[model samples]
Target: MTLVLFNKPFGVLSQFTDRGSPTTRATLSDHIDLPGVYPAGRLDRDSEGLLLLTDDGRLQAQIADPRFKLAKTYLVQVEGVPDDAALARLRAGVTLNDGPTRPAEVERIADPALWPRDPPIRVRAHIPDCWLSLTIREGRNRQVRRMTAAVGHPTLRLVRWRIGDWTLADLPPGQHRIIG
Candidate 1:
């Protein structure tokens, strides 16, 4: 099996092509040139971090399918510091438009040692922001963003730090390494 670990940068689409877009946008083809490899899962265009690509279909299923219950960890920067009550709500799972999310392992964390994001996250002199480390086994559409917003701490930035045993490690943004 051929596995590629890519540190996807912000504003880059998860797919290899941006087929019907009115305007040009960054896509995986800009980073990956390998044939047959496809992203095992997805990260939003605005979110940054570890993205797994593989040529094997079964491996892709194992990584992306929620039925497998592989844990995905994220380092999230939210608009405001979350109190214990907010963190508790996140840990217990909060109801969203789609439905209630599965319980997540959530904790307050210091700002991670990370590469500076280009066009850095907006700053507000009055409203303080904080970071959180969150791990969830389910991947829903914009679930992390929704979860944080649901608890009154909208995410200012989101980074997928790990998926199962795979991690971004020291790989810089917009870079890829062959892992298998």
Candidate 2:
């Protein structure tokens, strides 16, 4: 079984097949060429980084299943600088429209070391944005983006830096490497 780690760039879909829809955009075919491998987990088309792909079904499930409790860490840039109280709310579970999320390991951090996005995030001089290192074991749909928004700081950019024992490390955007 071959396992690969890829830095999923922003605006790339996680699937291999394109269904010929106008908004379906670009699929994994546009980047990766590994024939039998499938994505172990999903990152929304707008989000980026640290995606795992594997030919083994068991390995894919092991990484994607929440029961594994594999921590996924994201470098999130939000609309405003969050205070301690707001950060605490993030550390404690914040209530989203769907339900309450599990408490995250959250902390303020300096702007991440990253390659610039193709269509860079819009900047507002007066907004005073900030970056955070937020880690969670759950893989809810768009959870990171929703979490920051629930805390009154909408996320401007979200990049997954690590997933379980895997990390982006030295991989630049659109890069991939074989693991095992």
Candidate 3:
């Protein structure tokens, strides 16, 4: 059995191959060389951090399947300092275009010490931004970004700090490590 934790960098595709792109894009293939291993879940091209990979199908399903409800934690930087009401709404679950989300474990967090993102997130001089530590069991496309947007604070940067029992701890961007 093989379990790999990858620190996916910004602008990097979650898949090993960038099959349909009109131009070349960085992918897991650029970083990971282990044969027969596939990403357990996807991290958006614009997002960064912990992306699990596995050669075992059952293990991959356990990590990636929403039915398993594995908690995925993100350190999010948002455009505005969310008010108590906004935080409450996020904790209680907000209605998105697709549907209402399950309640998430969320709190305003101090800005984490992280490697700088390539090209960096935009900074607005007039509008102050803040960080949040949020954990969700469901994997929806851009769910964290959408959920924060629903509360009027758009996400500027998102990093998956942990997924299930694995973490991005000590893993720098564009690096991968394999464990049994």
Candidate 4:
């Protein structure tokens, strides 16, 4: 089975092809040339970082299926410093419009040393921003963003730092390497 680890840049689609969009956007094909490999899970167009691709259907299922509960970790930058209550809510799991989320491992973290985003996130001089290392066992659409928003600190930037054992270490934006 072929497995590719890609550091997806912001504004890029998780899929290989961009279809029917009014304007052209970067897709996986722009970084990956390996045929038959597909994304195991999606990273939003606005989010950046580690994304896994594999040729094996079984492997894809293992990585993406919430039933398996493979932990996915993210480095999130929120609009304000999350208080003890907000952090506790995240660790205990908060309810989203879709439904309740699985409890996540959450903690405030110093700003991570990472590649500069192409179009940087917005800056607010009046309000403070902070980062968090959040790990969740379930994949819900925009779950991290929604959770933070629910806690009153809207997400400013989101980066998938690790998925199970795989991480983005040493991989630059818009680059991919076959791991297996």
Global local distance difference test of model 2: 0.92
Error of 3 at 62 (Å): 0.9
What are the RMSD figures for all models against the true structure? 0.6, 1.1, 0.6, 0.6
Q: Candidate 1 lDDT (Cα, whole model)?
A: 0.96
Residue-pair clashes, model 4: 0
Local distance difference test, per candidate?
0.96, 0.92, 0.94, 0.95
Evaluation by TM-score, superior candidate among 1 and 2: 1
lDDT preference between candidates 1 and 3, better one: 1
> For model 4, which pairs clash?
none
Give the per-residue lDDT digits (tens) of candidate 2, residues 78-137. Answer: 999999999999999899888898899999998777899989999998889999999998
Candidate 1: residue 179 lDDT (0-100): 83
Residue pairs that clash (backbone atoms under 3 angstroms), model 2: none
TM-score of 1: 0.99
Per-prediction TM-score: 0.99, 0.96, 0.98, 0.99
Q: How many residue pairs clash in all the candidates, one count each? A: 0, 0, 0, 0
Rank list by lDDT:
1, 4, 3, 2
Say which candidate scores most in lDDT: 1
- Candidate 1, residue 123: Cα displacement in angstroms equals 0.4
Model 3, residue 98: distance off in Å is: 1.0
112-175: candidate 4 lDDT, tens digit per residue: 9998988999998999999999999999999999999999999999999999999999999999
